[model samples]
Target: AEEARQTTQFEPLPKSLFQPLPPFEDLPRPLSPSGASALIDEAKQAVIDTGSPVLDTEAEPGFAVMRGLALHKLLQMLPGIAEAERRDAAARYLKRAGAQWPETERDKALASVATILADSHFDQLFASNSRAEVAVMGRLEVKGKLRSISGKIDRLAVTSGKVSIVDYKTNRPAPATLADVPPAYVLQLALYRALLQPLYPEHEVSAALLFTEAPRLIELPPAVMDNALARLTGA
Candidate 1:
């Protein structure tokens, strides 16, 4: 029996690892525009699987994410360059940024950006009146408590005493209408509008989602934004 017996020892995990998790309110985490929208959706039990990372700068982003980044970078730099030279500049930047991308992928990004530049309807977006990567930070009341939120607007345009907040979306098969738009996206723009509105109080503040893949722009109506704000702050 002694010869056949096998001795085994068990190791306990660290006590810290075994400790019960704290209440939701006790664990503090920074909220980004996407995270805030996710939280709002979770509260309403309307969450969907968008599969979007919290930040574009995440380590080891997938091919699609990398493509999106390349497109955003191109958009940011293109506005500063004269329209005639944007294509060449875009080609050079994409060649460097997407060195490993398939030739087709590189060509697609170039074409999409080219479409955006050629669309006269978007003239204001690339005009001198607009700015890219506008940083916004402020405290807003949420669920009867003040919470600090910060986000960078992809594009901010001031024209005719009106402010337009533009966020670029690389999602394919873009929403055909406001109703088809994701609630998280709407929430994101609402938060941006709330933060920027005070800074340009005298001007009418508007927001839109620019789907780069389709080169389509969808402006968010005031009523839609108001509804989203109500859901966000529990007003």
Candidate 2:
């Protein structure tokens, strides 16, 4: 007769090095003085060297979000899967799933940030926010370039003869004075304005920030916008 069937059930494995870290870092160091653009350029070079496709248009946000979430998931289970496999599965699994992942923390953070938009509510709000409201959530595209760099515009409104360029801030609002606001925020909008300048030759390129987070308007004048463009172009 067949031996009595033996029964076994899976149990949680003993704790190992497979745990995850806190989602967000607690006040980690800031980006270097040179800023992120230099690092971006370096990455672009590496991609070119590896024959990666140049970004001609923005991909669907979901594609980005899923890729991000998968990475986070992989990081957590990598050790366990890795120990049973290569013992260095983080690098290999990342490659097998998708090669050429970004090495910098900023790019990873950006990927994670895209996850926020994956929320259907946020997506709906974003879509509704873009509708005729014209306060940002629109005007993001290659903006008429062969190989386009992505840009998130602040806002678009028809004011008399002018079409306003606007940006929103979830952080502390910048001061009305150019000197008072953070240089990066000013530059951020300035870059968008510059890229958009050729398209809107008629309207003056203006940059303003809505301090939704600060619950105030820290408006930067058009002159400040000009200064920002000047600095960007090294003019």
Top-lDDT candidate index: 1
TM-score of each: 0.81, 0.37
Q: lDDT tens digits, residues 22-80, model 1?
A: 87675234356755765565445855536562223323457778888888888998989
Q: Alpha-carbon error at 72 in model 2, in Å?
A: 23
RMSD of each: 12.8, 24.4
Worst 10 residues of 2 by lDDT: 47-56
Q: What is the C-alpha lDDT of each candidate?
A: 0.82, 0.42
> Once model 1 is optimally superposed onto the true structure by TM-score, how far is the C-alpha of residue 109 displaced, in angstroms?
0.5
Question: Per-residue lDDT for 67-141 in model 2, tens only?
Answer: 444434442343223233523444455555544445552344333324433335333223322322222222322
lDDT for model 2? 0.42
Question: Evaluated with TM-score, which candidate comes out highest?
Answer: 1
Q: Clash totals for all models, in order?
A: 0, 4
Candidate 1 all-Cα RMSD: 12.8
